[model samples]
Target chain A: DTAVSQTPKYLVTQMGNDKSIKCEQNLGHDTMYWYKQDSKKFLKIMFSYNNKELIINETVPNRFSPKSPDKAHLNLHINSLELGDSAVYFCASSQAFTGIGEAFFGQGTRLTVV
Target chain B: SQQGEEDPQALSIQEGENATMNCSYKTSINNLQWYRQNSGRGLVHLILIRSNEREKHSGRLRVTLDTSKKSSSLLITASRAADTASYFCATGGGTSGSRLTFGEGTQLTVNP
Candidate 1:
C-alpha cells in the first residue's frame, strides 16, 4: 500500500484557471504538510495541518488555499493560478507535530501553468 | 526564507569515489535530516541526525552535525551511477509545530 498518495500526478492548465490537488496518507499520521519545489529544485513549505487544524502557513500568495477535511487528507486549491505557480507539489505526513519523526512523502504532482 | 543552505550546488564524481556535501542552517534545530530526490520523484529520507549527536552512519552514508557551528555534512562512499540524484538538507525547528526548512539541494552525478 502506498503510504502517501497525491492525485493528478501531472497538471497542465492555462493562466487564471483554477485547479486542485488531492493528498491522502494512510500512515496514520497526525500532521501533514504541503511543499513546493521550483525549477531550481528548491523545496519550500507552504502549509501544514495537524489533526485537521491549520498549524503553519507560510508566505505563499493568497491564491493558494489548503483544506484538511480530516487527518488523513489535505487538499490544495489554487485560485487564479499564475505562471509562478508552475512547480512540483509534494504531500507529506508525520506521526506527530514534533520535528523528531521522519515524514512519508507522496510521489508529487507537477503543475504547469502556461 | 530558507533555513539551510547546501554547499556545491552541483557535484560530479566517478564510481567508487566519495562524495561530500555540506549544509549550514540559521537556527537551532531539534534534528536535521538528509533527503534524496531522483528526477521527477518525491524526496526520500536518507538519514537523520539530532542536535545532540555529532555523527551517524548508515551503510555507505555518513552524516555529521555540529549544533554550535549550525552546520551538517553528508558523506556518501563508493558512489554509483544509481546515486545520481539531488540531495537536500532540512532543519526541523519551531517551538510548537513540526516544520522542516529545506535547502536548495545539491545535485550529485556519479558516473560509472
Candidate 2:
C-alpha cells in the first residue's frame, strides 16, 4: 500500500490556466505538506496543514492555495498559472509534530505550464 | 533567504566508496532531518539527529549534528549505484507551527 499518494502524476497545461493536484495519506497522519521542486532541483515549502487547518504558509504568491478536507487528504490548487509555475509538486504526510518524525511522500505531480 | 545550505552541490564516486554531504544552517534549531530524493521522485526521510544529540546511525546511513557550528553531516558508507540520489537537510523545531525549512541539496552519483 502506498503510504502517501498524489494523483495526476503528469500535468501539462497552458499559461493562465488553473489546475488542482490531489494528495492522500493512508498513514493516518495529522499533518500534510506541499512542496515544489523547480528545474534547478530546489525544493521549497509552499504550505502545511495540521488537522485540516492551515498551519504554515510560505511566501509563495497567492495564486497557490492548499486545502485539506481532512487529516488524510491535502490538495493544492494553482490559479493563473504562469511559465515560472512549472515544477514538480510533492505531497507529504507525517504522524505529527517535529520531534524526530519522519515524513512519507507521494511520487510527485509534475506540472508543465507553457 | 534559504535557512539551510548544503556544501558540494554534487559528488560522484565509485561503488563501495563512502559519500559525505555537509549541511549548514543559519539559525538555531531543535532538530535536523535528512531526506533523499531520486530522479523525478518525492523526498524520502532517511535519518534525523536532534540538536541535543551529537550523532545517530541507521543502517548504512550516519548523521551528525553540531550545535556550536550550526552544521550537520550525512555519511553513507559502502554506497551502491542504487544510492545515487539527491540528499537534503531540513531544519525544524524552535519555530512556531513546526514548519520545516529545507536546504538546497547535494546530488551524489555512485557509479557501479
- Writing each residue's lDDT as its tens digit, candidate 1 over B33-101 gives 999999999999999888889999999999999988989999999999999999999888653247988
Isolated chain A TM-score, each model: 0.98, 0.96
| Model 1, residue pairs in steric clash | none
Query: How does the DockQ of candidate 2 come out?
Result: 0.64
- For candidate 1, what's the TM-score of chain A, rounded to 2 decimals? 0.98
Model 2 ranges with Cα > 4 A deviation: A98-100
Cα shift from native, residue A33, model 1 (Å):
0.4
For model 2 the TM-score comes to: 0.96
State the lDDT of candidate 2 residue by residue for B54-110, as single tens digits. Answer: 999999999999989999999999999999999999988775237677899999999
Q: Evaluate model 1: give its lDDT.
A: 0.93
Off by over 4 Å in 1: B94-97
**Pairs in steric clash, model 2:** none
Q: For this target, which candidate reaches the highest lDDT against the unseen true structure?
A: 1
lDDT value, residue A34 of candidate 2: 94
- Candidate 1 on A1-114: residue-level lDDT in tens? 999999999999999999999999998999999999999999999999999999899998999999999999999999999998999999999886876578789999999999
Q: Write model 2 residue lDDT over A1-114, tens digit each, in one string.
A: 999999999999999999999999999889899988888888778888889989788899999989898899999999999999999999988885655277788999999999
